[model samples]
Target: MSVEETMNYVLKIPWHDIERNLISRVQLKKIIKLRIILDKREINYPIYFYVGEKRDHVMIPYVFCSCKNFTIRVMSKKKKPSCKHLIMLRLALDKSMYREIYIDDLTLLKKIINEIIRIGLSPTLRKLLYISRNRRYERGRTDGA
Candidate 1:
């Protein structure tokens, strides 16, 4: 029998691990940064990041980021796995542990509601969560490549 390696689906991550390892340290040095930029009017505001002052946005669900490492390492032919920014987002939404600072702000709630009104809740979330492939392939092409 031949042994084959299989890829794991990482669409969902366990929330507890992220909080325990990552979120608990946000207030420590202030060098590693992750900010959900929600206006009092809209939830679509970008996520601001600062890893050694290099800024990026970690678009959730699909886990896309603007950091150079993500662009060159993950997006540009060199297929690497997830980065710390993606993991940060995964752990950002803690349910039972500490309060997520972004969501705790009442202004952010109004923005989320306004965003939901603009696009409807389901569609907005779908757009946020859809893991789209690069444009090199055809739109509907699916052959299990």
Candidate 2:
């Protein structure tokens, strides 16, 4: 298999399921660092990261790195999967030395929304959400609501 596939497979294994004796913390850190370096060298995009606090545990959501390609398409009003950024983020997380953070598809959106809420931008986001929902509703309706 290709190196990317192999690394992805290794990272796909949940941290809880992995044997503690098989992988050392130091090794995990090394993996994360290497992935970050590779991502920096290859992908030229902005990455969004989120951290949350709990009583004793910290909540680190999945990473979302938006591709310049995807952003450009979005600006041009097109829909497409800019997989390069996602791949880079995955590669980084898979190889990360830290065990706390998990990268999922919703990670980026959730982080951004949470930040908006935190900064009291809820009203604006709510309006946008409402407009989006209404647009979908109108599209589905036989008569305009």
Candidate 3:
């Protein structure tokens, strides 16, 4: 998407479910199946998914990815910024978000995913966890408390 198009999506007409990527100017549909597998031991699993009318697709190895946008825009040496997938990859490596995954370690990713499955993931549970941890702030428990 071009800068002008992105701006229109963000300003002129807003998408209800659109979320601002903390690290980029793009508004991406919620990323699903936060999966990461590298090295020979990685298991067959679902990774990043596109949220659109079509069915979800799997994330191929970066080099092998169709990468139409990047190939068209970057390979020919355009002046635009990188694509969303590349931006996502850079975010994953930044150590700022997605603290659950170990960007450099496959073993850690496996362990985290297994734990999430075992404990279960739910919006209510997540909200409850947040509230419980920030009880002091949420309920105004200040120094006087």
Candidate 4:
């Protein structure tokens, strides 16, 4: 199903029902315990930070998450459209389940950048570089010939 459809479905139904079917026990636990901080200073686009047991993840609601689960499973393998954090955020928004913490936009951006630096380049970035190098090589060969 499309992202929109999935989000709409989740929003329409209660979290309890959706939790039983879609979320695993471990994910459910995280959802309950996770601290969601919202930086809504930017009126057009709000930033969400999900503080998990081990690490903090930067998310853009339903759009993206800095978690490995999202990068590997959702983006790389296509096993799922979203990670537990994203689903939790969606549910939280609908049911008012999250704790609203105020963070300034600049600090939030710095935190997100730091998180990315700590995690290093993702698989998508490596793939993009590889493709770019191959294109340069192909162009060079044609010009040399």
Best by lDDT: 4
* Rank order (by TM-score, best first): 4, 1, 3, 2
103-142, model 4: which lDDT tens digit per residue? 3344545655475448642333233334655878899999
Candidate 4 wrong stretches, greater than 4 Å = 1-17, 20-44, 104-108, 116-145
What lDDT does candidate 3 reach at residue 119? Answer: 41
Candidate 3 residues lying further than 4 Å off, grouped into runs, are 1-65, 96-145
Comparing 2 and 3 on lDDT, the stronger one: 3
Using lDDT, rank the candidates from best to worst.
4, 1, 3, 2
In model 2, the worst 10-residue window by lDDT is: 50-59
Model 2 spans > 4 angstroms off: 1-121, 143-145
Candidate 1 lDDT tens digits, 1-145: 0011101223355555555546654333212222344455434443433232223232433355555565676667456665555555444433222122233254544454455344333232223223322322445565444
- TM-score of candidate 1 relative to the true fold: 0.37
Better of 3 and 4 by TM-score: 4
lDDT comparison, 1 vs 3, better candidate? 1
- Tell me the deviation in Å of residue 54 in model 2: 15
Root-mean-square deviation (CA) per prediction: 19.0, 17.7, 12.2, 17.7
TM-score of 3: 0.28
| Worst 10 contiguous positions by lDDT, candidate 1 | 1-10
RMSD of 1: 19.0
Clashes of 2: 6
By TM-score, is 2 or 3 better?
Answer: 3
